[model samples]
Target: MHRTYSLRSTRAPTASQIQNPPPPPSSTKSGRFFGRGGLGHALRRNTAGAFAPDLAKKLSQLVKMEKNVMRSLEMVAKERMDVAQQLSIWGEGCDEDVSDVTDKLGVLIYEIGELEDQYVDRYDQYRITMKSIRNIEASVQPSRDRKQKITDQIAHLKYKEPNSPKIVVLEQELVRAEAESLVAEAQLSNITREKIKAAYSYQFDALREHCEKVAIIAGYGKHLLELIDDTPVTPGETRAAYDGYEASKAIIQDCEDALTNWVSQNAAVSAKLSVRSRQLSQRRRNNIKRRSEQGVGHDLSSQDAPLNDEVSWESTGQQQDEYDDAEEEEDDETEPSKHSMLLNGDGSNGEKRGRSQEAVAA
Candidate 1:
């Protein structure tokens, strides 16, 4: 015993059978029986000999037809399977893209934060430099004023310093004034006034350079973010890509939809094939029954009843119902539930699959 529908023929078609082929059996509305008139006509119209060669030719043609339909069904099932494989590959690719973009966004965020910290740090440095410059000026201003006053007083004392007591005291006061001026100069040197001036120039240059560099990088990153946000995603708009992230996402969704539809279509065709197999079984049985009633005991057991012992006709309807139930259950559990026609294998973004949670999180 083998599968219920075996299109194999024991004998090859003769040249006469090829030239004048008989008609195949017609299916009935009940789906279990064939059109009696068609089968009986094929069997009775032959008058060549005792052996119904014409009837045999008709049965061969029927088998050929079944084989052709079965081949077509198998081809469709294969196509549907190819679509599923492509869907899985496309989905994994999209996941990679989403992950890549997510990583890039994270890097951008971290870089921006570093730039902000640099900006604050640079500003603090600039502020401290300015404060040191102000403090140095405040410390040196009084000494500079005092030195100018002593020069003026010594000019007047030089004219009266020979013998008068007031002249001697004024001269001594002038000497003390000169020494105080020298002391103030030494104190100013201790403060490293020249070094502070040099620091002012160099620090400002370094800070400006650092700040400008950080600003440029931060600006560039911000511009990139804006571009991503501003890109038009609506259909019928311009096409673009940010490292192909958006395009890949759209493709993944389209593939998912196509796979779902193809799978559903495969299920439908499988059901049809099952029905067709049953029809072929019933037609063969009818022919055998008629032959037996006429006392022509032609053996069709090998051709008609070749299914596995575990398989029974009683469960055919139940099996189909179960297949349909399983299909519905699978649709509920998977993501591509919405119905769609698989027009082509190309993953075109002509339609939108609703935003997925993973896409949103990324």
Candidate 2:
């Protein structure tokens, strides 16, 4: 039997310890005025937003709360390991079947603790990503302040000195400030959306994996329980000798192999939506598509004036070409008639020609 499997103290490093080193003890004493919960957790939650920039205060508080959550998980993992060790120690003096099963259960429980510790690390990744959003929010505040200040100054000057030369200069400064603020606001919006999606996706993925692995451990723990003989025996009759030692060991090995090979794609549990849920989900998707189409239509309608202007300019150019061609054809037709009239020596044609020549000379 492995010494690591039991609570026996040994100078040499145990297999369990080597594989998953225990986390360091928390720096703060476990029990103070707040008991095991720690005073820092309460203080952190209540005071986190007090000093944060106005724009970032709420998110800053959220980040602090997440830190508290991580701390709680760490405490839980450590306690779980302690309980596992205690369980193994208490079972050492029990019947052979009881001892074997409890020890194996301890192994599974300790593995759960290790999984929790790892989950805390992944959760911190999410918290750090959220901090990026807070940082961007804090940086954007200055641009907003600058724009507001410029507008106030321009307003104050226009009221006190309506014709002040400085008003024009301040107006120019205000325009530049507004432009800078616009860019800063746009960057803040883009980064907030991107980081929020990334952070939550990371958190949910970690949570799913942790839960699935814990479920796997629980199932195998139940298998280990079956090794013990639970049948009612006569008070004087002794139970049969324990022959499940090898079987118990096999169960533990199988559990370890299962956990080692587990992956997201191989998850046994799934959330299958019911018919109503499927319909509701599809309806939501259709509504989003409809709204998007409406938005595109609105955008196109707003652009109609420019498109109409371009079409009118094209049509005007074509009309001008036709007008020029018509004038040239009319001039060609009239010139022949005027020449024939001059050949007949009509007095009216001669008089009109003399007047046209006099008007040209004039």
Candidate 3:
């Protein structure tokens, strides 16, 4: 049985602590509001992977125990019937054989009753724990969402404007805040999930164990019942039957109390793990995003080379461009003049073309 927990030192949270406590839940809307994917998208995430294997194992074991109990119950019932027949024979005062079956039958019945009571009580307790877990899961959802948005916005801003140290500091604060929120959400989720598993596990184990015990007792009682049926009733047989009845009555009544309460501290352990792990995962993502944004920001903010170097390159390029432009203009001017000269060649300028020119001149 675990003891209850009490916090040590009853001081209220300081302003700094509250401010720095945690990050928000990573909801898409909140992420977007905080510039994470919007809350709608965030809801779509982290829904699965919650039901782990340990829970399955516990449930499987419970099933096996139940099977054993059923088989045992059947065998015990048949044996009880045989015992009845023997009791009738004994009244006839005939053959000599085994002891009376009444006591054994009584014991078996008592055990069954006890097992049933345990079932009811244990289930009630489990229901209570489940309720608590659900309540906690619900309570934290809103806060978790709000925090996610802040973290996202901070990250987005940091990514967009990397040049400012003040912004950097502000981004860091947001990241820190988001980290805290992630932790809280994870812790809450883990607690709820783990508690549910444990509750089911406990119920299953208890039921299985009790049923197994019952089955065994029933089998033994059946064997005794068989023995009595084979035996002839005599004076001694009367005493045996009476004793069997009383014992069964007591055992059956007590079986109701067979259930044990395990006030779990498992919830706390799970909560701690959940909160820490969740926060850690988120922080890792945030760090990666932050570094990338910072790198990009740094690149953007880096100073350009001196203005003198820029001016020199510009001047050189302009000079080359001017030279090319002049050369092109000169070529254009020469093309037209060359064509006109060919077309209007005078005899003196082109003595060989005089014949062609005279023909055209005429």
Candidate 4:
């Protein structure tokens, strides 16, 4: 009877088995037992190789979804400001006794708050999913490496003489490799079938939910703008409302742009700092290694003093920023409230408003 041989089979081959080994076409290349693909894919395709490539592909898609969600949230924030300006116009044109418009404004603010909360929740879920996938892939790498080494050893043994002293050692190794490879394959199978499916489902649902919330936010914004446009008012009041809204939007946009720029710059700075630190660490390690190879003993503690100095400088900068914030807070508490001046029409505060208006005009 002819027996079939599977890759990484634990059975020890008899002399007859070695003379006429059963070889599957898929496992043959260059007249060798291992397949055409590299060692990384020789054992039923690394068991996890099928899903390994998909990890980065899914992460890229998730990142793109996150960017879209951020843009939508920014649009919603701008719309909230527009709605507030419209509510302000409604208050100005009506009699002092009218409170209904303010009530509507409150409802709109509450709805915006809810949308912001939803965005935060979805973003958190995205981060968790990304981290889980990365960790799973990392765990699978060592098993794949061990399997590759064992396969290479097996291939080397195939070329050696049958009566060589290494045959017994090779047989023992084959048994060990078979056991280890089977365990790794089983682990990868479970991960790909269960964990990966759950993570992908969560990300897909989160992206869809985020898009729906953004649509609802857009609808509410369009409705509010239409109400403002249709309100009956004098031409001057109408122009003034639009002018204020545009100016507010411009200021808000400038602030958002500045904040975005600041974040990008800080991120770049942090990355550069991290790279510099790693480079310094590598240099120190290389110096120590070279010294040891030359039979010399150098004081690494003294050599590392410069790295400590850089750490202290970073701490100092953080302390300075905290001090500046404390001083700004004190100044704000000592000064009269700008909002109170705008609302009260105090004669003394009118000069402050005029200066502010001049600054805005400039």
Q: Is candidate 2 or candidate 4 better by lDDT?
A: 2
Candidate 4 per-residue C-alpha lDDT over 324-355 given as tens digits, one digit per residue, 9 for 90 to 100: 34312312333343223322555221222111
Q: What C-alpha lDDT, on a 0 to 100 scale, does residue 281 get in candidate 3? A: 91
The best candidate in terms of lDDT: 2
Give Cα-based local distance difference scores for all models.
0.36, 0.65, 0.39, 0.40
User: When superposed on Cα atoms, how far off is each prediction in RMSD?
Assistant: 49.8, 36.4, 40.6, 29.5
lDDT of 4 at 201: 64
Where in model 4 is the C-alpha error above 4 Å? 1-117, 157-162, 217-226, 229-362
Ranking by lDDT: 2, 4, 3, 1
Superposed model 3: Cα runs more than 4 Å off: 1-107, 148-177, 189-197, 228-362
lDDT of candidate 1 over 1-362, digit per residue (tens): 00111011122442322443322321110111212234423432332112212212333233333323322333343343344333433443444433333333333333333233233333333334433433333333444444456555555656655444565665665566456545544544544454456645544543443344434444443433443434446877754433645443343333223322322112221223588899999999899789889987333323321222223333533543453343223113333311112223342111111112242111
Clashes of each: 1, 0, 30, 0
Compose the digit string of candidate 2's lDDT tens values, residues 233-283.
988999888888778767866776677667677778788999999999999
Candidates sorted by TM-score, best first: 2, 4, 3, 1
Best by TM-score: 2
Candidate 2 residue 165 Cα shift, in angstroms, is 2.4
- Give the CA lDDT, 0 to 100, for residue 71 in model 1: 29
